[model samples]
Target: MSINYPKSIENLIKQFSSLPSVGRKTAERYVFHLLKQKPEQIKLFAKYLHDLPNNFKTCSKCLSLSEENPCSICSDKNRNDKIICIISNFQDLLAIESTKKYNGKYFILGGLINPIENIGPDKLNIKLLVKEINSKLKTLPEIEIILALSPTMEGETTSLYLQKILKNPKIKLSKLAQGLSTGMSLEYVDENTLANALKFRGIIK
Candidate 1:
């Protein structure tokens, strides 16, 4: 346990350790691996990381990470605007998109409701979602809002909170079929399974 490494390398390890799921050993390995890389390559990587936070912004409509305001999906004319899929994060959005069975727009919640983490509905872009729904009702064929969130506790909490707020007679709200299970995340589900589940989404009670 000798602290003999250079200050810069130690600092890199600390930075990597701050990332999710990266332990001290993994961080050290990553720093050493980067040391083997060319100086220009490392500089480019560092520059990208440094610029990332300021360079990207969340999409106004879907809450997806993008440099543009609305993101490509929200602006795409070919996408079905009528059915908006509600997901916990961008990963779920990508999961559903991989199925190629859904053509609707999406609303990324950014994260789920976790009381322990103090992440509530207000912290999410729920107000913007409501505005989007209301505004689209007049101009689009928008009829349904599909709850494609995971079956985890936080996901269920988030979905119920949304349902309570968006309980309008004019708009139909539905949840994905029971095949997703109570604790499974959409990210791990197969494309065919996700497609089938979406095809048979049930009306939320």
Candidate 2:
């Protein structure tokens, strides 16, 4: 589709269109909306976009993006270190936290196992996760892992792979119960449903 706007507006629209779920029409609307804003407002928006990458660092333990190295959750002394909730990404971690039903540490897997996309265990943070867990075992007497992944096919595959590799008599593994519907993403689920799922998590055999 050809844009009638001049080069500057067209370039801005193109950049906006490059974002996820944003088409040319949507990008045009976004650009027009910004055009109506005051110069200071637009500058503030540009500043945020420019500083986003430098504002946050990945937590060494959970791999969550934060301003600090360990992140507030991983460094929290009040949290239950014996329980670790494994999630697919930072969004899932935030979803679970919104429920306020869990007080455990977390490990972000980075991504799920999807053969079609050529993403596998090697592409994810599984190795770091395993190493982190085993290393923590020295301090914590026993550990319980809560697999809080989505109920999608890729999520299931990743969970199974984790179950196999993390198999240990000392470590107990469990997954969120059917409180969450199949094929649903945790980030979009309501707090009540997520809370129920965490409350009724089942052991994975």
Top candidate, metric TM-score:
2
Task: Give each model's whole-structure lDDT.
Answer: 0.89, 0.93
Highest lDDT: give the candidate number. Answer: 2
Query: Pairing residues by index, what is the TM-score of model 2?
Result: 0.93
State every prediction's TM-score relative to the real structure.
Answer: 0.89, 0.93
What tens digits encode model 2's per-residue C-alpha lDDT throughout 92-192? 99899999999999999998999999998999998899899999888877899999999999999999999999998879999999867899988999999
Clashes of 1: 0
Clashes of 2: 0
Worst 10 residues of 1 by lDDT: 134-143
